[model samples]
Target chain A: MKNAVAAPLTGVPTPDLASIFGGFFWVGISGFGSALPFAQRMVVERKRWLSDAEFVDAMALSQFLPGPNVVNLAVTLGGRFQGPLGSLAGVVGLVAAPLVIVLVAAGIVARFADSPHVIGALRGMAAVAGGLLLSASVRIARPLWRKREPWPIAIAIAAFGAAAVFRFSLLECLLVLGPLGLLIARIRRHPTSS
Target chain B: MNSPLIELAVVFSQLGLVAIGGVMSALPDIQRQVVEVHSWMTASEFAGAFALTQAAPGPNVMVVALVGWHVAGLAGALVALTSLIAPPAVLAYIVASLWRRFSGTDWVKDIQSSLNAVSVGLIAAGAALITLSAAQSPALDVVIIATTAAFLGSRIQPLWLLGAGALLGAAGLI
Candidate 1:
């Protein structure tokens, strides 16, 4: 989670609005396919805006809240230094290019949606995407197993069953399990406090 | 009320609030809302949009924008993207300001660890369901999935794998 390169920068000036905007904009442009890995590079290593610890904190904060992890990281870091406008600049800069690109791609796909070749390509890519998702799932789960706790693992299984097997709506799953999970956490933490 | 734009706004905003574990964990529900509940797109069309968004740069959340585009237009895309991101972004900003105060609290740590586990489970379900809808050739897709998983720890860029998938598809080999 921590990077050695994230040692606090001693002489780096506080980034201005333009730099924040431009920095994230560059992240948007170069972040082909995925942005997090590059966002980490830019924020922690290249800019030294956030230390490795701070970047990891930002990531945790991003995941703790909703939305994409990278966008959340940008907004949080921007807000940390520059307040609301910084948040705006960070999000807008990060999203600008990708929004246009996705829109254009969507248009092209619409036009060729029926083409066999287009279908084939999309199908192939979709399968690959599925694989990527699987990898991400396993990666995320590995930590839970390493923690050696039964409750977290049990919660994971229940969640997987509810969504993948029972076909519960996301809202339903969250409503039933979100609080339960939180309560379990609280109980585990305060085993003697309560 | 019946406007696709309005529907897009409502659905995405709701999703934005509950999109724990990032957007990946929300994929199955998103597919459900857009495809099953509203019938905005077929399962394959949803899968197609997911693929396109993955191929494009930026966040995977843009799949919402693409779905909106399919249903309404440019305006729809903007509405979907904004609604989906705006609420969460606002929440993120508020929490970031407060994070320093709560950073080392045991409760915060518990919540974080708990959410991590739940997120993993949801993401796994999403991956399985999406593959079921998107995979055209089951045998080939399984191989693709396994190979991709194996190489995940390697240094190869993901774009290469995506590009390879497209080539295989274009050649009708997958």
Candidate 2:
């Protein structure tokens, strides 16, 4: 009965700014195309700072907000753990290494942009990267599996169609679908007493 | 050739403002602004930078930095990247603070769920867009499908897949 109203989770010790930087800095260097898996493993399994469900909640929150999802997650998670400085630390940790590495690679690659093998490899890499991204989408939307409702699926399809098929401007599409989605979610907001 | 550091910053900042679901959602627009609008780089070069991001560690948005370097050296790279990341990171910080304070509420959860639903669709669209642009041959198409299926079905690491791609391409198989 004490737990019936879903009291906010408490007592997870917040990591200091240094650990925050190190954890996400590791995420920066370790990830390939998408950092969500690595970030999830770091915070959820290794750091034990946030539980699995909390990790998912953070993912959902960051995915919709502006900026890179990884950066947003880092900022949000870092802020939750410490404060604004932690937020800055998280983002700097996630971005600093890749920024240097990518710039250097860009420098070297510019000299070789014309080689056919390099070009072909680049093209092939794009296909696989696309695959990685689509696969990630399949993975990120896992919670819908529990809902067992068709409306969420339908909304997803409509969004995919509008963006991928119709090629409407992204802002235009979001504005149109945003309210409908809220209405659907509102209808299903019955509170469950745990 | 005239695309400069300030231009990179201004364009990326504008992109940052309207990039509702992150930079992948803004890919085509980035292509538009970077390739056609500003003439910063060729379309093929832009595509190549994107591929570089896939191989390099971290988020795919690193392609912007690559594009910046390609055009105007280190300063351009710094400008493009900071403009794209800084604004949104601040916004994320502000929103995250508020969200943490109000997170236990039911309405907040409901709104989050709604946004989540929409994100599912956006992710699908983003994957489709990248796939369409990259997979132009039957062999590449097979690579795309196989990699995607494997990723969805198994826990195979993405680095392994990218390595396979590089090997296939180096051997001229794709």
Candidate 3:
């Protein structure tokens, strides 16, 4: 998947490490609720290091593996462009900004956990977080729903039903779905060829 | 104290490596480990801490720091946060390098596309679980469902909805 184009000459102007780090830092810091969509917009659309196809690929891979999707995406995309060092840079940029903000907020919450006002504020924030998460689900689902694949859609429904209704452990649910997905893919690949 | 702190760091570091579909998907495992196995906190306490983390403005993984802080102290919080982020960051670096080399293959593309749909399902399931846990009262349940509907409707920006929820809470309606 290495792009055929040569790396930009060292002396030529390019997006500096500082600028790239800053961009990811802001994106990470501002990610209060809907960080994934915001990060996608910044990296894929605004920065243009990756095309739509590549962005989708990176996102897909990240989601399938462990860790936060945004962090994984950063590493994947960064490595694609600038090797292991770039991946390190991207991860630092992506996480440090958000981690700092969260630490400060946690301290504030600990200080005021007993206060009525803080309690009320937290309640409200919780509701809003629910909204944010719901919105993200819809945003992610919209594209997938458009694909018109019955099996994937069926698997999605079954997975959701199992988790939401049966309260299956996340690992158990994935264990059931992961192999099923792989089997389906294999079948599709070698259907008549097999 | 040192043992718990180290344990907290190690467990959450392992969690960071396996937290697919964000922190929420890992919630079940976190609850199982911390509340059930380690006896660090009660299930209710973990739920409460999760509420706080959701309210806070950052990734859900930040909840690890809050839980660690509660379990030990500032030092615990630092350990938990580092463990939660650092291991996964390193893992992502290794995986990214390999991905870049092999991503051009047809099978890779096909598998990636199929997994996208599955990811959406996992995320939705996680949200549904959170909604159930957060809605304690019938009125609050209605509000939660309404907010979810509003989110799905695409009627307003999520931040505005947050502002409204906060205002309602301030007014004692929520």
Among all windows of 10 consecutive residues in model 1 chain A, the one with the lowest summed lDDT is: A1-10
Candidate with best TM-score:
1
Instruction: Rank by lDDT, highest first.
Output: 1, 2, 3
Q: Could you tell me which 10 consecutive residues in candidate 3 chain B have the lowest summed lDDT?
A: B43-52
Report the C-alpha displacement of residue A166, candidate 3, in angstroms.
Answer: 4.8
Candidate 1 CAPRI-style tier: medium
Per-residue CA lDDT of model 2 for B39-69, tens digit only, reads 8877656766787787889877798888788
Q: Write the per-residue lDDT of candidate 1 for residues B63-130, one digit (tens) a residue.
A: 88898888889999999999999999998988877777788688888877777777788889988888
lDDT of 1 at B137: 71
Report the lDDT tens digits of candidate 3 across residue range B77-154: 878877877777677666765676676587765565555555567677766655555566676667777887877787
**Which window of ten consecutive residues has the lowest lDDT sum in model 1 chain B?**
B143-152
Worst 10 residues of 2 chain B by lDDT: B95-104
What is candidate 3's lDDT per residue for A4-57, written digit by digit as tens? 122332443344566567657767776765467777787666766655776677
Give the TM-score (vs. native) of candidate 1. Answer: 0.92
For all predictions in the order shown, the interface RMSD in Å is 2.7, 3.2, 3.1
**TM-score of each model, in listed order:** 0.92, 0.83, 0.81
